[model samples]
Target: MLVRLIVLALGIPAILALQDGSPWPVREFRGAWIATVANIDWPSSHSLTTDQQKHELTSMLDTLLDQNFNAVVLQVRTSGDALYNSSLEPWSYYLTGRQGQAPSPYYDPLEFAVQEAHKRNMEVHAWFNPYRARSGSSSKSGLAHNHMANRFPQYSYAYGNNLWMDPGAKVVQDFILSVFRDVVSRYDIDGVHMDDYFYPYPVSGVSFPDSHTYSAYVSSGGRLSLADWRRDSVNTLVHNIYTTVKSIKSHVKVGISPFGIWKPGHPHTIHGLSSYDSLYADSKKWLELGWVDYMTPQLYWKIDPPQQSYPVLLDWWLQQNKMNRHVYVGNYASAVVTKSWPVSELQRQVHLSRDRRDQLSLGNVFFSAKIFSHNDHRIGDLFKSAEYSAPALQPEMTWLTAPAPPVPQNIHASADYRIHWSGDSSGSVRSWAIYRLRADVWELTSVLNRDTLEFAAHPGYYAVRSVNRLGKESDAVTLHVGDITVGVVGKK
Candidate 1:
């Protein structure tokens, strides 16, 4: 039953009220990675049909929506392949039973993902591992003969059980850029994301055989050392991708989640594999140079660990954020099931992030999304009940420009006390936020999707504002409530 209200002289708060001492910000990034490689997160298995795969994805998104998650980082290009249509690469073996084979009914997962995520008012970031040729086992022979790895053997190298595109080669960089540009130009994604697999995690007993490429660079009068040259190669790709994505769609974001520890002794006490030295990824320099829109270091450790303290590393990353880009902490939710980490471990991490509100440390992204559906250790419930109970707009990027939509019109009160307004058809408006006057202030009651044109009034002063795809809110239109007769309804 809707509660009756008389006009109050006091003003209500303009946002979703902080109900339970919540330290959450009005704008925060809450997302999860939906890994599709080797069926780590989606499809459960490669044997599922198209309808079944669709059902599993829908259910995952539904779970996130129910838990109030606002974004999804979906792995589309897992290992030098495409989950969507592509002329450059073959179909992902994890998506179908075999590589180079299309779904029986033929559907593009990236397109379907963007459409479904938008319907739920969730942003979908298309995640790709730019240089990985194959993971775990050699799929080189299985890959289509026309695949780049097959066509251009000189561009790739085999190390351990994996195949990788030599980062030192200019031709390889151009090929990778073209593949990603194809996706960015065709699909309507919110962001382009990549994981920490730069130069591939070091494999013992065998080194990445890039000597030929390095020798070529040296013969061409390159000045830098081998290590610096490798970092420069990745840095060039990072800068190129950032510029290319913005050139195509300025509002779309570019994010990278690199290895957590930058350098062991940089923090004095912390000791771990150096992302800078071993992986040749200069994540710190990237932030200092403003090459990325956001950075998520995989801070997959307990808060008070002796060496790899989560808080200590979090602060270190924050200080390195010279560009003031969004720095989301990469959390390991799958560890809860695999390592039996207490559910409270996740809660403490969330609290630590909120408590330390530095300029760069904004929000979090769970490792994989599947565990949420299982309710493993009640991790999902803890987040929903505590930190994420209130809704938040995706954190804004002031560097990108987007037109603020015009205020919605035709605000009127219906005879049944339901408020109605004219829907914006400009295709920019993503949803409408309904604000109600309470305690003399306006507070957000609901964020109605664009299709929802009317809202049942709660017998109070109301205002509606349009929110754009970039999470920018428009000025609101007001609708006043008056004396009306309405019947009471039973409680659920």
Candidate 2:
């Protein structure tokens, strides 16, 4: 009885807090990162058959959908390496266990991942770790052809064994642009994502080793500090990335996940660690220039902590995003210490952000995929709460138009084989999701590949929901085969 009462005490407010009383905003961006750096999130511990890699990834998408996250920032290219087939950079070391090696089974991971994510009505933003050349640079540990350390010796630098591409070099900028052009032109990614690693954070007593590049700039009469010049390099890329993406597919979303502290400018305290001067992430300017459709500042630090408060940074960002881009606060959900933060604290922040979305159109994106699976995860509890439990159509971008795919036609079912009105031969439909009825309830079964509409009769009953480019699922078109199967057996 004591345990039950204790539970009730904690439960009541959590239940009330779960209420979606906050009026849903007209436009919001909700997403999470699926990190591939050092095999952090997906393609776990590599060298698995290509089929296994695809299966593991599909499971990740399933988990994301269950948690009510509508978008996935999947790392497509990290460290000048490609997760999908690429001719420019080597294959990702994370994928095939060695850099420059293709997947053993000859399948395109990008093509497969995007299709699977779309099946669950989720967006796959192509996440890239720009400027980070290797995990931690040991020349022997780096990819052989990674021009940063090899072919273009002038534009590379070493700090603590890790090598980084020179963000200051014009050639590096063009190379990065080429990669983005390749991705946006080749794949069906809904968004292009760049994370917070622009110029590596300063290490104590160690310069970035860019004196040669700095000298060259000085010779050219450039007047800026090392930090400010580094920031301009990133700013130039940010401007180019936004323009290049829209030039290719005007509707494709362009976004960044920068470090949370823009400058540690709060008069109340001293922040020795700041992104602007140290890491050179000029994220606030990106928002003001409208260079990004959405920005996820890694507000990873705790709320009300001495040096920085979560709410303090969030408010500062809100004021900066007045240019109309979505400001999705990136919360550190997985590593949260329960002792410091009761479950409600994080949920309250989410509620607070949503409550004030009108001021900034802000939403929350948890840092990763696994944290929400934890029952104790604040965001997890928030999602399971009936208020957020229901399906939410992804906040729309009226900014982009996705015409509805043509309707499925000639729908039919049979004992021998089942069929339906499916396939968007117009070459526009993304995929079709199949659903089945159990009594009065309709549940999604499995998503057939793009342009596929029929299934084998042996696998229970059947139905289908065609999905469009915008991840909008259509009403289920039922194809009942139970009667036909029984009748055919009787005839036999």
Candidate 3:
């Protein structure tokens, strides 16, 4: 009878459907930024107890997971201090109430976030502000004893209301690189992320107090003009970060979210702040040189605006992708809540990004994680119902090579209609992709963590595939369920 049932299942055309034409498992990089500076997103306040903080963080992660977000760019190093335990820098005052203080109950926040995010099958990118030492909005408390500003006073300067580390200083460069190395070597992060704060945004009348550093550079036989020199310094740092991260973990991605416009007039009609000249961030150069695995240009404008038009700028950024890397648009989710912009604007931007899905325009990362909680104008609800309705796997990085995970072993369906499988001993498996065939189409039902070996099954054709840390999917092992009485393994 079992053999006859197997033959009958094989005869069913829908049971033999392959994964090639499946429209369900979409591959896109959906992410959100959790800003820690000034406690903008997480902790809600510096006074939250350790358990409270954990609860808040877990709640945020749960929200993102429900929304089907695939990655999170967490601000681990907001300023010069550390959100997690670090010997190189003191605890972030934003995490605790005072500089150089630890949480009352000792716990590494980065480690905790990584473990929790991985359990939900989301990627965590450690976000760092490479050059800003202290923001104007930071507490007026004294700098920590080990802070770069205190230890290397000559390299740190107060420009406008913020203290900044001199990008031209070789010592400063080495210190930043050491911090990157420390985090990448110690943590299981999926990527290293930096934002548009390379050199400080200009203040009207006061020039950056880097004349002394410039004079030293000239004496050391550096002949480039000040602007070119500054750009070069920032470029060097960006290059070094990419190489260093790849050396430590080749699969770990390096990403940058520069200001929306690279430079005005590059596209003829576009007019805005030139991140190239002002911030000393040659972000276009970084993308062209293939220094970053993904570039999320902060194209945070509406589609209708002509100057900083979202679609226009998005197209320009894609055109600059000479290396054919991923370009995930940095959307302005905060605009809806703060500026009272209609939620439909953001929804349209998602549609525009999807329209260009074939042109290396991969995904979108909203400005903040807080807007979801605010749920202003039902933005979160609209997204979950429309563009983000289904789960998506993070796009594969072909440059970062890893062997495909082994197929799930002994995939069996029990009499109780529960499907079970065991993973190999290789330990490379990170998640499992479960698919169910409905209406002659295979849909990715869920991507569960490695520890999940059994799934509550329904009467249908189901398949399970192992997914590795690099987002590589193994071939599928199929099973057919009938009447909750018999299970048959379908040929792939």
Candidate 4:
């Protein structure tokens, strides 16, 4: 039986009988955030041996791969530190027990993560907390001598037991840019991701002590309101970061996961912490100006809440996506923690994202990665049986351009029913997808990386499409085989 494809941005239609039973889209952003702060999702703890860290990360990637997740947003820079080698910042205490201490015998967690993730055909986006400096337990005396906050106290401030970089400081912006530049230049990361920690969530009476910077700005003839100035500072960094990443590698995406509520009264009766006023993120402006390649807002609420409805908030964010960039809805996995949330809510949220494909909100990314291994909540089983039974290609980013890869050159059946095809030499081809014609409809059977050039064929017409590093696909080349059929295949 033929099923409607869910991945197509085929546009809306007048009448439709399509149901959830339809074939899951071949392109979707099924991802999970692998948080490393405080060892919440990785390493198990900072004290583990280097071997243990590698084992833990490998296992996590393997599990997510089996579950059909295409991307992992790993916390490489948890709080003004590096999970990988860096001359600009000290090592993250989360990776080693002490900040500035490298892993025993030396190993780069970011490098390892990128390599392992690629092995599984999963894209890795280096997640960075741009403004956060120190966690609650960290103290200036205890921080590394070379730590940015310690080295340049003027650019940093302590608020409620944590250190934060003054967003308004030009030096802070330059330092952050250098740190990211080093990362993008040295690593093969798929994207650079930032979360919604701008200006820190408002404390009841505590204010972000940026008066000195604000004073300096006003003395230099700044007239914008403090809020607008703060927003502008963040906007500057966001836009510069996008341009910088593209300059280094035009295909690498830049994404931000801002707080769900953009601002109060933006859809009326939507009551929540205003990312605009409180956090000074002005994330809506980022979307409008086309600064980010994708926006994954943390929409953690249940589907129907009296104060902040999930769907309402989702639609609001979708409308604000004026630049047509990708928006992957971030969902909280109840399984991540033993919470009061119903297990079914995770599945429901996934369905919501898929059902509204035509309306924008292209895909979904779970808040965490570890919980799926628990199996206590049966979250893995639910996805395997429902949303993720089939494999998916990571969605394309039209903004980052790359020429379509050339089709496979030669194809023929070898011994033992195994099919062989020549690999393309075009630098753009990262992998190849094998599709078998079944019931006169093309069905994806497998996706092989550039390393593998053959697969065991199970009989039928076969076709291959080259996928580039940015996940863009080339035209297909097909070959029909029944009795030793051999020839250069053409597009179907």
Q: What is the TM-score of each candidate against the true structure?
A: 0.93, 0.78, 0.93, 0.92
Encode model 3's per-residue lDDT on 274-371: one tens digit a residue: 99889989999999989999999998888997887888888888999999899899999999878888989988998888778778888899989989
Ranking by lDDT: 3, 1, 4, 2
Off by over 4 Å in 2: 1-28, 140-142, 267-272, 337-342, 373-382, 398-492
Q: In model 4, how large is the Cα lDDT of residue 440?
A: 52
- lDDT digits (tens) for residues 1-492 of candidate 1: 243233333333333455443333666789999999889889789899999989989999989888878899999988788899999888988888788899988899889999988888889999999888888865477887766688679878887778888988898889889987999999999999998998978888778899999999999999899999999999999999999998888888999999899999768889999999988999999988888898988999988875999989988898898888888899988889888899889889988876665565778999889877777888889888877776666877777779976677777777788887887878889888777766555666666778888998866678777888787777766766666344433221
Off by over 4 Å in 1: 1-16, 21-23, 415-417, 437-443, 480-492
Per-residue CA lDDT of model 2 for 253-313, tens digit only, reads 8888888778766425536467888888888899998999888878777667757777777
Compare candidates 3 and 4 on lDDT and give the better one. Answer: 3
| Candidate 3 wrongly placed segments (more than 4 Å) | 1-25, 137-141, 484-492
Q: Rate the local accuracy (lDDT) of all candidates.
A: 0.83, 0.70, 0.85, 0.82
Model 3 local distance difference test score: 0.85
TM-score of 1: 0.93
Measured by C-alpha RMSD in angstroms, how accurate is candidate 2? 9.9
TM-score of 3: 0.93
Clashing pairs in 1: 10-440, 11-440, 11-441, 12-440, 12-441, 12-442
RMSD to the true structure for each prediction, in A, is: 4.0, 9.9, 3.9, 4.8
lDDT digits (tens) for residues 76-124 of candidate 4 = 8888899999998999998888899999978999999999888788899
